[model samples]
Target: MIIKVPGSLSIGQVAESTGLSVHALRFYEQEGLFVNAVRRGPGGRRLYTQDDVDWLNVCIILRASGMPLTVLRRYAELVREGAGNAQERLALMREHQERVTAEIGRLTESLDLISFKVGVYEDLVDQGDAAVRQCHGPSLPDEARTPDLRHEAMAE
Candidate 1:
């Protein structure tokens, strides 16, 4: 049973505080991401406590960090089960940490490639050769004939 807590917040208030849409809050509740049952006021309106808001903030960060809903739900289940599950929780967090670390490595590599391209463009601009390099054709000078950078992906 959900105890009536002092300083209960309405759904709208929770949404505003958490930067989540009301719909997303409902979806999170539906997805079993809340560790405790959501409380309701008279006439069955959903009410929330500061603890709920705090928990949702954690959920927000976890989701922002790319924790999938299933994994989050499992974590919530473990929490709701209560006591004696430290090992499982630790294992779950360790696995997610590994994935996050790997993702950071991948993103770093991608950033390196983007930085290299930026350097190339900056050099072209500095040399005032941007106009010459913009058009790719056989008539261009040898130095400007580096390679066809006219790929569709580079159009952006």
Candidate 2:
């Protein structure tokens, strides 16, 4: 049984609505990231719907947040396979949630550090600290001070 969505969209329309390029959408399809197979129009052009675009937006967020493609593909496969694996899918999501939580923690910590640094700079600027005006100082670089959230997420 095939389920039809509310509105049909061309690849360009999907790309525009989802804020992804046509190439990225095609790459996502080639990467097995789609939960449902896209329908094709005459001449074998890819056709999408609002639901597909919405799902792709979720995929983009998950991918951007450092969820591995393998894990995403597993989730998609379970979804396509349907109801029996609901528990398993939930388990996978829960695990991913844990990882996301940890990443949020790291990011929060990084943000705190940045905020502290910014406050210190503000104080220095207000006080006219001569050292703060110099381009070269003993202060650590921003990248060095903060952990890489993407790497931290993938490490989990």
Candidate 3:
């Protein structure tokens, strides 16, 4: 499925190659996140080129890293505009990079706490009287507890 497909590729081929469902491909199209318009063939079947598949893979990675659909659409728009918007694209990517980095730190801390909690449980399970350790984390930052503060703070 991961061939350097020449000419036009069917939606199924693209999906298989990119590890996305056909529905997701359609959703991305509907969300206007594609740099190139998906061309249609007989019977209005969506056809994708190799470059489109590559772009979809990139989009998949960005989405996996927690990029919001809106932001991704904006990034795709910037890319579609060609060369002049490089600065804007870079700014958006840099912002996302910072957010992703912060998230990694948060996840690492959480995993460490979880690992420690596991050890606490293991010790208690084996010896009936082990000191129960508390893994207290910071109160859900104002952002996690509040749903509407996205506009006021770093939502990511």
Candidate 4:
């Protein structure tokens, strides 16, 4: 969906382009998570710019990665303050990156386990293993059930 670059867009345009609800866009603004201040039209209706769309993309990524709103607000505040806090901003991003990396690792491991289980199921189905098909349960040994990476990560 070609986003117009030069002129301001209405709230509806921003919502449609970003795949976010109008209420959610308003919430993001009210929560101070947005970098740009939305301009108001003659009737005090919100008008968004291309910069707002760009910033919302960043916000969507950060939020989806499980970054807390407080952290996002702090990041937004850093941008608003402008200059001289590069180190602080870097640190914040680095910290979130670490968390995202950890989450990715956990998810990857879980996916691997699930894939292995699927393979086992496929093999059993092919072999016509009635017992395995009836059970449809995890093949993990009893001792392997506790304190594994998947359990620990999901418990968090």
Candidates in order have lDDT scores of: 0.79, 0.75, 0.80, 0.81
> lDDT tens digits, residues 1-156, model 1?
122335899999888888899999999999999999999999999999988988898888888889999999999999999999999999999999998998887566556546666766786888885344542222334453223333422554
**Winner of 2 and 3 under lDDT:** 3
What digit string (tens of lDDT, one per residue) describes model 4 on residues 1-156? 345456788999899888899999999999998887888998999998899998888888889899999999999999989999999999999999999998887676567667766876688878884644332234555454445743643442
Clashing pairs for predicted structure model 3, backbone only:
none
Best by lDDT: 4
| Deviation from native of the Cα of residue 119 in model 4, angstroms | 0.4
Model 4, TM vs. native: 0.82
Q: How far does residue 156 in candidate 2 sit from its true spot (Å)?
A: 30
Kindly state the number of residue pairs that clash in model 2. Answer: 0
lDDT (tens digit, per residue) of candidate 2 on 1-156: 123346788898887777789999998899887888999999999999777877887787788788899998888788779889989999998999999999887777667655655776787788785645422222445555444543432342
Error of 3 at 112 (Å): 1.3
Clashing pairs in 1: none
At residue 145, give the lDDT of candidate 2. 43
Evaluated at residue 69, the lDDT of candidate 1 is 96
Best by TM-score: 4
